[model samples]
Target chain A: MDRFEYAEARLSSGESFLIREKGVNLYDGNEKTSFEGGEVVLTSHRLLWARPGDIPRGLTCLSLPLRYVVFVEEETGSTSFGFSRSKKIVLHLSQALPGKIPGPVNRSSHHYMKLSFKEGLNSNFVQIINETIQSKKWENFSPAATPSQASDVKLRAGIVGIERGIQEKQKAADESISRAFQDLSKLMGMAKDMVNLSKNISQKIRERQGDITEDETVRFKSYLLSLGIDDPVTRTDFRSENKYYIELARQLADILEEPITDVGGMMALTDVYCRVNRARGLELLSPEDLIQACHMLEKLNLPLRLRQFDSGVKVLQLHSHSDVNVVKNTALALEDQGSLTAEELAQMLGISVLLAKERLMTTEKYGKACRDESIEGLRFYPNQFLQRED
Target chain B: MAEVEWPWQYSFPPFFTIQVHNETRTKQIAAWRSLILDYHKITKHCILDTREAQRTALFNNTAIDRKLPLEGIVTILEDLARTGNAQPLDKQKHRWQIYWHTLEEWADLVYSWVQRCGMMNTVCTLYEITDGDNSADEEFHGLDTEIMVKILQTLEVSKKAELFDDNQGVKFF
Candidate 1:
């Protein structure tokens, strides 16, 4: 506990939040401490613990710098009945340095601490913490160094110095970019890390500003790209065809539900193929496999379904968009207006004219509406034959 | 006589286009049939020429800039002929003899008129029955001679009238 200093419950410059776990109890070596049911936040530079809501409220909290952590390991124990008890993470600590800030304990008998997770431990949390510690990010933040260091001081003055500095920065950026792309294998090796780095950079920018870009298309693209499917299901992952397709279908539903809704409840199968492949990154999904998975969507009772139009154009549509509902809505629109053309309906519904025509054709097929073909174009009207006696 | 009152559908643009849908086309043809009969009956028109019909007000709506295509006109006229409301005058079907009333109905109307006038056994020239002063107020006034001959032939077959040579006149029995 003496290793923990009373620090403000906020991140310092160059520090970023990594992971957080709730219902954690701090242990002073083998003995339990007063800190129970507190939240533990693991940042790039420190691990902070506070009462449930203290960190969010920006109150003072206990902080332990990553520099003090020698290593960490999981302490697992099973009861006599073979039931696992609460999991814990043991952090081996070095000696408290001299002139350190005051803490809950003046001196400690133990040189290590344990964090007990009342809820089961998340393997991901431990993995991320180990990665953060290995990165040694805390070593880069020297407390004694000022923001404007002597190394950054300009030995030369005037526009020449500014130009030289800009050139140097550009040269460094060029060298790093070239090095990253020097070999295909090297780039492949770093692709996962690059993706994580890019995500972190964007998150940091978003934290400082409202968005990374003002252009809506770029923002939307980033949003779609951000919805990545980690560890996409592949055929090799399962031995049986049925199991493979079912798993693939579930993953597709999870990734595509929001995007399909945004696109007005329907998307062409080709467009879906493109989006799924992009989200899966290098694991390109074949068209046949996509169709097979889509077929299983309904068998699994998912929220989406595969539909083929009369023209043989296949699309993925939400279950809520049944033909009966579409026909009913189209008939209402036709009745509201005396009549409608495909172009006019497209304008009213904010959809493509081709889709509007398809909708009208569906309504006509159901006998809810009729069409008039003329030089002006084909128009649709509510079916009056069923309505009128004459 | 007052001008003919057109149906509301006459002004609708799509009415000029033959609908592709079966139900819609059925109703469209029915409407066209009635409109044609009413228009011809009011105007006392006995013959319809397919080539000349395009310019007529019945087939063309200048107000809406919509004209029934030649094929659409033929389709409606064929539908009428199928139901005994019209007869193609030529093998090419270019000219049609429109009967607002069927020949049997016309025969009945002429026979009743003769009986009401106490001319049951009198010889009546075709023109006198169609254009003479005595029949001026009649529904068949100034009827086309060709159609009048057909109507008289129907009456002759029923023994209600006897037609003279060359269809010049007829004698009521």
Candidate 2:
């Protein structure tokens, strides 16, 4: 089955999307026992009843094809069993099985399949079933014609008007094409002599665009004349460009997630900025924009959060990250060497020395570690707790 | 000469580093206080110059190749002073006289020594108590003169000894 979308009433592939209503109901078929509060799905293909995430085989629920559905009728009398008004869908099948049986089978014995729904829901449901039975394909089922079609027609007319305007513009473009061909033919005949003149015109155009001095424009135009992109992205492509930027952000988030885990669930924001921009190739983002995107991730409730260290080094970390693990790791590392330098811890933790120092400081705050500041630079050791060595 | 065995942590590199965190630093200060007192007792030395201690093996462990910088030693000494176990001997506060034994303890020792030597009523010069040949067998022999004066002053304050200015000494009664 195709992946199920949570709470979506739609069906999977090979199943029909034509769901009239879906809610808790009873399926009392050939068996006297009733399945209580089971999710009843009425589709064009089958009457599928499941237990939320479970599509049980034989015991709880079953899928009865619509072809076997003999009739569907609403029993409007409110029963003491506390249905809003139970409606039963009856199916005459070629086979009787105690449990759910998938696929086509030859008839051994005939049996009836009955399912019920709550009140007021059976009217449109019966109509939908009738439509499904009469129609050749499930796609043909539609409710009564609506005014939306009329609006659709008006929209088509508006598009036609716009097409006419485009055609008028196309006519002007065709005229320009012909005039450009005439100039091209003249240039072909006088190509050798007009080269300098064409170059001068290009230079003048470059000058009109501004910022290019005469000499540099003459030099730069020569380079542009040799090569140019067909359709470089611009302001007109903002919608598509925005989509690409969002994709880049997602890619950056994915790339950083693993490295962040490898480095004990935190990474320097500036280091990530350089990495993300480099990964984007030509589409680099400014540092401020990268920070904004990180903020956006926090708002989106992604498994990432931004934090600033005491040394002012901003870091991105997993949402579940805590200092408890760092303290534990410090004690563990101390068990191996009894003492640790900031550089050594940096190597072991896959982080910078500055970050390692930060972790050590936090560890010391809890008395898990103590530091020695000597001529060899600062180092940390497991303190009273780890020293006990139980 | 029997070699004095230092604690295992003395050779540990971080032992020389100044602790920055309060909890760890508290433990570190306590450890240093004991070490300083033990070091003075073992070496029979009293004065601790911060600059000199940086090179001393007790403060800087050469075997582990870790040296406590002068600043760190000064910090530890300042903490010692705050705890009343050491007193700064100079205006610059760089020189400190470690009180492995408090002045009162030294005064008691001296009073008992005078009684044992049958000099209870005799006037003894301050130099005789510190550097004199008679005090050679005593634990306070070659004691810091300033510390000796402080000890004598304690004894005088308690009426155990009387100061005699003419002889620049104290007479025990």
- Against the true structure, whose DockQ is highest? 2
Residue A140, model 2: lDDT of: 40
lDDT of 1 at A122: 78
Local error of candidate 1 at residue B91 (angstroms): 2.9
- How much is the lDDT of residue A222 in candidate 2? 65
lDDT tens per residue, model 1, B42-141 = 9999899999999999999999888899999999999998877899999999999999898878888988999999888888799999999889999899
Q: In CAPRI terms, where does candidate 1 land?
A: incorrect
lDDT of 2 by residue, A1-390 (tens): 111112333354545656534444543443433454566666665566666555423334455555455555544344436544555655444433222233323332335544555443545766787677666353343412222233334332455557756877999999999999899778656743454465577757755867667787767766644432112222234566445444444555677888788878888887888766555433346777667667667656677777887778788888888888877877788778878888998998678887888888778887888776655667777785236432
Least accurate stretch of 10 residues (summed lDDT) in model 2 chain B?
B1-10
DockQ, structure candidate 2: 0.37
Per-residue lDDT of candidate 1, residues A29-145 (tens digit): 988999999999999988999999999898999999787888888875542143646788889998875445677777889999999998876788878888888999977886563
RMSD of 2: 24.2
Model 1 preserves the real interface contacts to a fraction of 0.32
User: Candidates' lDDT values, in order?
Assistant: 0.84, 0.66
Residue B112 miss distance in model 2 (angstroms):
4.9
Q: Chain A only: list TM-scores of all candidates.
A: 0.42, 0.36
For residue A283, give model 1's deviation from the true position in Å: 3.2
